[model samples]
Target: MGRMYGWVAAGLLAGVAQPALAQEADAPSKDSGDIVVTARFRNENLQDVPIAVSVVNGDVAASRNLNTLQDLSTVIPTVDFRNGQSNKDRTVFIRGVGTITTSPGVESSVSTVIDGVVLVRPGQATLDLLDLDHLEVLRGPQGTLFGKNASAGVINLVTKAPSKVQTETLEAGYYEGGEGRIKASVSGPITSTIGYALSGLYASYKGNVFNAGTGHKVNGYDRWGLRGKIVARPNDDVTITFAGDYLYNRDNTPQGVYVSSSRIAYPTGVVTPNATLAGLLAQEGITPSANNKRVNTNFDSEVRDRNYGGSITLDWRLGGGYTLTSITAYREWKNHQTPDWDTRAILATGFPQGRDDGTVDFDQFSQEIRLASPQGGLVDYVVGAYLLAADTYERYQRSVTQLIGGAPVTNNGVANYGISAQNHALFGEANLHATDALTFIAGGRLIHDSLSYFHQRVSDTATGVSGIRPSFASSGKTDRVDYSARAGVQYKLASNANTYFTFSRGYKGPAYNVFFNMQAFDTQPLAPETSTSYEIGLKGSLFGGRVSGGIAAYVTNYDGYQANFADTYLGAIVTRLINAGKVQTKGIEADLNARPTDRLTLNFAVARTDARIKHFNCPAATTCTSIDNQPLPFAPDWKLSGGAAWKLPITDGLAIELQTDASYKSRTQYAITQTPDTIQPAYGIWNASIALIGDEHWELRALVKNILDQHYANTLAYGTTAGVVRYVPRDNDRYVGLNARIRY
Candidate 1:
């Protein structure tokens, strides 16, 4: 950690001589020009905000073919996400901080907010990000203003809104291997005081992997989405906006490519395959393959997801130089998945050798009201109140089947769980300008959170199995009050150059471990996790708004740290959350842009993170061991990314553009208690694109992804008996595509 900071200090000192210039202009900004963001709850120049945030424009996403969380993580430093037992369930991590449990009782430390509305579950973050105006990545604790669950950070998505001008855009593209996609959007004025916009998208791709066992293609993808928006301005002082959207995704389950081991552990430390496993494999006509990309499963594996939502926002100006804003939103998400947990056609020990089902149904509602004094005052203030209500239902089913005396025996078991939660918060912030160049900010939030949970299991087996838990029923309720606060001071040395330091405390309410191993549900409530973060940085514009960026360093300390432990029960893999004691995370981040010439632009960003458990003692439940000083899982030590864009004019109405970007990550750990087998080697990826623009609102583009064709696993894990198993569910290979667009 000391050596990592040494380089960061030297780099900052080297750039100290560069002259910094003023506030960013409001002209149309692209790749590296005067980036603007809403990280501070208002539209402000990125370089002026005293926070560490990365803003990516919609044009950049369109040119780079970035449509998924994995793709977005590549360009942003200190961000990563992985699939859970079900691919639809995504777990996002920032700065080595995130949740590993996908159970209904657990919530993610990282928050995903779209247009000021926060999502309730990690699965909701997997929805397709479309028609986005910009994406903002805020690092460090943000609970003081956003919410209590934003203990790690926040990802904000802002979509394009209705426009007054009449316009339409159409685009189509084809990738290698017969995949096709199309997008359309139209917006215009409907009346003197109203405007409307409509947009839709559809895409499909043939799977790359073939299932020899079932003689069907595996891992195919199908997606569709639609959005409608309306904006009304009845008077000069009142404005209202209504937005609604629906997205559907259906894809084959990305089962772990089997490597080895399929047996339940016994008390005597003996392992053996299922009694009738060999016969069942033969009956299913499955031939074992050594290739990792091949699928050899007997059961059907797929995931179907539906996400829809709507929000209405009202902004009104009142008497006495004040403005009022109100927001109301409701959303629902449902996912059904059948995953081949065993990854093989053969059965293990129990009656149902391979797992069959998992489901999650979630609904959420939110409202926020805010009143603020107009700008241009020595002391400015904003006060707000927020409320959220959510409900979730989860179910899991197991197919209990075995071959007895050459005859097939079958039974079924089901587990059902429910959780309901409500949260109320009052938050306010005020800015005090002491001098012309010095300003102070302070904010705080008071939140009351409550939730109820219930779980039930049903089965006919009278005798309990050695490794599996029997049917049981349990219910519990928990409630708590959490508080978060923030304080910061900014000093401006010149019109454009400024440096600031901030201290913030964030809180996350207690969560349950709903995925019971039958080892008891920890009737006692789990302790809530809390973090104190300190950050200092320098940011400013330069070269007349053509070049702008920032450098920041932050350190965070955690109490009652939460982490995961993976274990096997009844020949099936399961994960459990534990209070892993105190942990500390320290990191340095730097970003810069240079537009030496009007036609060429370059940008660079780098981050180094060191997250480790400071203290942890073994628990009394099992033979668990202490993991002191161990680095957190999925936290990379170093990440570097950069890009360059160059444009050339051909004629008065035509132009050509070339853009390229690349990223490299250092060795990362997949298990908190790291082992030689759990470490992922360092890897890099590159993307390049070329485009041509015409005078009549027409454009053509060509893009290549993973130019080196790296065959690295997105998520890698290794076990004693299982050599290696990875969740390489999608896009592990290189891709080439061409797209064309027309606008009127």
Candidate 2:
């Protein structure tokens, strides 16, 4: 089925290839308009870039109510986002490749960059985006220019700049389930040479999960943030910009909900009821169900996160049309969480039963300098150097009570871990115009990484439980150097159309599994991951600005893919990161935007991905089965998204607008082992909105999300003692809301 779609896409590319129309000039029509992008570190027309990229304009995002990366994933079929126990564990995937782990020493394969500053941790990008100018998602490896940790791809976000004219904006919204939000911003010129912008936001939600024990909502949040920017011209030849932001978030959402008590036998593919877990649940008068919406926990979970950052940028126009750019940045993230591990209201002989508290502190400093030659020459180039230094510290404490020989017993333990890292890189890219109709592109990066870790564990009392481990201390260090490169050629089929093919090499640094449960064997540094990818794409416009879009096909293979698998630690089920063997992902993607008339617009996107394991290096002392051909977790075979908008004039001073969007994905497996209990069935969601707009001052909108009230899990997993558990998302139920905005 996937092969068929690939062929169809290839045919479409061929059909669009036509001889250059000498009558038509080699430039885009004025009616088509132009989208400017910095995908290659320079402003260029989107259709001219030889890469597979997608753009989301800020105005379109505002109308769709997209507030975070997770929200953006629904409209981009080639990307996927997953949430975990807390913000620190969230993960993002592009082209079926991503790293999933809680170790601070490890970096994500997919990187996030905001306003030219790369984020040290993926969790830092989870904050609500505000006043965005636009967003770009680049598929496949992007390490040649973006640098390390971009082996899979990159998500680039650009915020609105300070305005030359004075402006003030205010917005307020209220949704079902007691969710409310307010936002305001002001921008203008401070002087003839200096301009400034300031924005602030506040939001609150009264969760959806019902806590049967406490008679209150369990998964709710309160968030607020502030951002400011200043731009100064200084002189006709130089420009300086400064930016800073701070955010605070607090929530009480548990790791997951108990969904079932079914267990599967290891290595035999047998399913049966977990009698032991069922007996324990019955003691507390609890029954597990697939549609479970209530949880009886004795304690409330708490997660508090604080993030802040600042950056300074300098751009200088040198002699002979040469440009020099420098950027320096510093950022910090601190998080503290208290979770109820047991998820039950059982009475025990302890002050606080079945609870764990953890804290993390991370900081990073980075500097980048680059120079670029002027465009429209036979040969143009960009060269850059990057340096990064980062450190992370974590502290964890666990307390639990269990029945030992018909008597209640209590146990307590604590663990501390720290990691330090440094990275340096030199990168460059150049384009050679062999002819007016043909061009060649090449880029490469040389990177060096140094990483080290320290860890210690201590127990307050000796217990007979098999899950307890002896006190221990461990440390390790590693260093390595690697390189990534890309080569491609593009041919202009016509004035408004082009075709290109490229090969890329991607690399990710080595890592250590330095977590709370780290043992002697885990001290060894895991092998670095590497990949090679091949891609062919075509981009163009048709019908004299009526249609514009792109189509691409890609295949990527990875060695030493980093993933989490189920294992046994001291007679208890546990999950740990390992260098899972080889994996390959091949797919076809297409996106289209059309303006049939001045009153209507339509957009569509689709992806057919086949991500599978080519080899499995089964870890010793672990349950092993047939998994060589299993699909990677969170990867679906097919994904699609489409939307439409229509504008109707009510009068000379007012108008009515209608919009709707829909998305769908095939079934997904949530575990590497392909366990039946960890499968999420296929699902789809639909949303629509109606708005009334004034000439240029104010607007009101009414929106409905999850129109079908689809009930599905965001993710599924096997619990150590609770059998199967699932994460319930906020959109599992239908909801409606109203938003209002004023501009002056």
Candidate 3:
């Protein structure tokens, strides 16, 4: 069946190509009005780029309310976004590969770069999106030209720049069961040679989760942010730009609930279920049902996050048609959260207080200087140098109410960890216009990274009302050198069509597990992960822009795949990071766009992934369950998404537009070692929006999200004591909103 589908897809491409050649004498196809992006360090048409890339425009994002990464995934078929235990934690997967740990010293496999600056932490990428110019998702490895830690792929976000023309825009909206939001931006010329722009955003929401125990709302949200940018042209050949932004957010913490009680029925081993904990939750007024509305917790919890950053860029057009560019950036990020560890209100033996407090801070600085020769020459080249320095600190505290001298008292344990890192790199890429129909490209990078860390763990025993002293310390340092390379050939089939094939190698740096608990294996840092990928694709327009499409197939092999393992240490459970051997993923992705009429447009995207762990062997202190051929975690085999839009003129100055989109995903497992409780069944979601525009200056829109009110677990986890618990990070109920915007 899969082979038949593949054949049909290929046949459709061939059919389009045959007609395109037959009409060679005809006029060239009209532009599809497709977006342009800077994914390859230069502004180019999306279809003209020799890589598989998905572009989403600012207007489309505003209409779809794509304020977060999770919202963006609905449009990109191969992307998946998952939140960790806290709402502030983010894990983004592209092409079925990504980093699994949010600990300090570990970076994301799929890097997120904003305006040419890479976000040092994955969680920082979850900030609200406003005044965006466009977002580009580049599939496959990009480490050769892009910076390090891009073993999976890259998500590039470009914001609207300061313009010479005066413009102002304001938008406000309210959601039925979600939130209220307001955004404003203004741009104008500060002087004949300078331009400035400022933007601000505010949003708040009373979450859907009703806490029956405390009579207070859980998972509510509140946030605001501001950004300013300035551009100056000292001369016709030199330009400089500066940008800064600050954001603050606070929200109630999320609580996990039991989804299923079924245990893995191993023939030789006995596993216990959470019957007692389930009964206690029920007794505490917690109700777990299809609606998933209520959470019972005796402790108070909240999440607070603050992020601020700035960047400066200088560009100069040198003699001999060469361009020199320099980018310098600095950022600071801090986040703190308090969580109810037990998810139950009852006072149990092991989790009497059931409280865990954690805080993380990061300060990062980076500089990049690159020079590019003019394109269209017989041979063009780009060379660059990069430097990065960062400091990270994390503190965690776990508390429990225990009996001391027959009286209840609190006993707390605390752990602190810090990491300092420095990285330097030299990279270059060349494009050779070999012939009229074919071009060859090659790139390589040499990177060296050094890291040092200090950590200590301590505990205070209950002293009938007071406490005791602290414990020991540990320190370590390590450094290594790594390299990446890429080679590709692109053939121009016609003025409007192209075909390309590329092979690339990517690398991720080594990391240490920075959790509070101490496990023997976890104390030793894990090795770096690497990947090699091969891809081939075709892109072009058909029928005078009435139809357009691109299709690509890629295979990636991973060595020393990073994975988290659960193990026992003196009767207590601890998670250790390990290199779990080889993994292979091969997939095909297709996208189609059509403008059948002047007022009607349609688009669709589909992906099929075959991702599996090729080899694995558990380390000591860990149980070696049978998982040799399991599918990679959170990777669905098949995904489909499509949308349509229509615009009709109602009067000389008024028009109405309607749009609808839908997405579907197949069943997927949540953990590397497959378990029945960790599987999330197939589900689908639909969204729609209608807008009224008056002279393109004022507009009103009505949007409906999750029109079907689909019920599915956002994430699932298998716990030793709690069995299976699912976390629903988003509201399950349907959401409806009305927005109004004006521009001048």
Candidate 4:
């Protein structure tokens, strides 16, 4: 992102050089233009909200420290994540569309939603970093208003509430490799209508940025979090709020050791791990040879996660403008992984192994109610109701042993499972007018899904007579109901010029964790994939509101698709999810945010996509002639991003903030005759940050990410392994320092 558009064009050119060097000649204006967002739920004014949303705040996500959610797409230009040797992986795409599956029973095509609940798995999407109040990147295919898994779009995380008067904050920081962090918050008023708030955070890191030569010790990452809130407005119209959060992390992710290999060839492409097969540990007594040399010397691994959630919100104001809203939520999450798959056999001998332990558990429940109508007659309204329930199960086993010289003959691996789902929904939206430059918009959603999967496994030494068994409740259980709708039209040549057309009927609800994988003594269940989308757009503002832009075009149709393979059932080598057949997609997108003066401001976005498979028959397209048409694994058919920020306030708590960003995308192949192990090449990187607020009660910031350490790769193979050796980390260097405000 061209170092984030050169730090926002050097803080709007030092705030246009402090009033053109007139030495602040007449202060008083922080209008701070643009930055009004609600991501369609009515709050309009995001240049009129036709769609394609993106808003950032919470002080630019905490002065760019960005904490979690894997750094939110290097400044939000569609988003990205997929890293080395698997760190619980993730895949997200918008505009070009996307779906991710790694077989813990698949599920996730974007739909993170926090503050309105709905965080459907991926270990609840890496939490922590609170005290926020903005983050909405809406985009496309919200399945008629965000239905089951969203089909590639929706990430609304809004926080920051619980202040009735008394407020406080405190923060500390240090960074430049060996990291550190601290945070605190407070809010008051426990009477006269009630209120309360509390927050806490702590972060730690070592995550060694690589100096590689293969070794024996490398520390990992660590984190911690806590949040709480409560509010009540008793009388005058009714309002209530409650919230809770907790996070725990232990990342120690080291995985960097793959010095040599060859059976099919690792020849320096590296995938290391065969510490002489633990030298058969004394030929199998159990433990010898100095406790089996710490189990193959630290091949890089450490993961542990614990997340928590809670939410409640209500606001009622009945009269004239009409309003009523309610939200309820629940969540529980867990993750624990032990990695170190052997780095050149623990660096040729010194050893390191915490053993291969893995586990996961996530639970969720949600409820929503809504109603709002108001805005000068010709009609404007919104209504909603939704209910969702989730029960989750996940676990994988590992106890790789051979150790002849150290001792433990044979014990391979396999243990996996998942089942539970229940859902319901009702929704509506309207905006109509007959004349005066036309206007009409409509929306709908009515969906219900009920599912329960049965069958569990413990694999008794690869089917050599296991003890526990029960398969898919005798193969009977499945239910689905789907509906979607949307219509749009707008025409106006003044009032900031307008032109819009839309047709949406998106619905996705196969979500039994993305298709099937059989083997719970027989598996069957993988169906549900649907879509319909078409759009048109134009919105303009020139010279006056200081030039703004928009342009859109789209088409999508997907009948069904779900394929994942790497078979070896009775012999154990997991990963299977099938049912692949139809698909169609098309696209064009555009964006601009100009500010020709007032000391410069510019922003841009562009995209072009073409997806294929008019009919797929799998197993190498089976006579479908594999027209794979390439460029869709990590979809990047062409994209661009722009940025600029400049400001200066030498007086009044001294201010200096400059920013930047630039981007490009093209090569990203995963098949279709482009093999060189299915491509991924094309890179760009740049970044910067600086801040000093010191007394709105103290605030200081500094950040530099990638800066230009470019090594590009953020998505590729996951489970069904044919060997890709994972590498999607484009952050080679980063430095951070922050401190924040308002009474300690």
TM-score, model 3 to reference: 0.92
TM-score of 4: 0.33
Give all candidate RMSDs, comma-separated. 5.4, 5.2, 5.3, 23.7
Worst 10 residues of 1 by lDDT: 16-25
Candidate 1 per-residue C-alpha lDDT over 93-160 given as tens digits, one digit per residue, 9 for 90 to 100: 89989887766776788988988888878788775677777788899988877854888999888888
Error of 1 at 467 (Å): 7.8
lDDT scores in order: 0.73, 0.80, 0.76, 0.58
Tell me the TM-score of model 1. 0.90
Which one is best on lDDT?
2
As for candidate 2, its clashing pairs are none
lDDT of 3 by residue, 462-549 (tens): 2211111244367777798998888999999997789999999988888877666643355677788899999999998877657777
Residues 529-617 of candidate 2 have per-residue lDDT tens digits of: 88899999999988875677789999999999988777765344566778999999999999877777777777778899999999988
Write the number of the candidate with greater lDDT, choosing between 1 and 4. 1
Which stretch of 10 consecutive residues in model 2 shows the poorest summed lDDT? 17-26
- How close is every model to the real structure, measured as TM-score? 0.90, 0.93, 0.92, 0.33
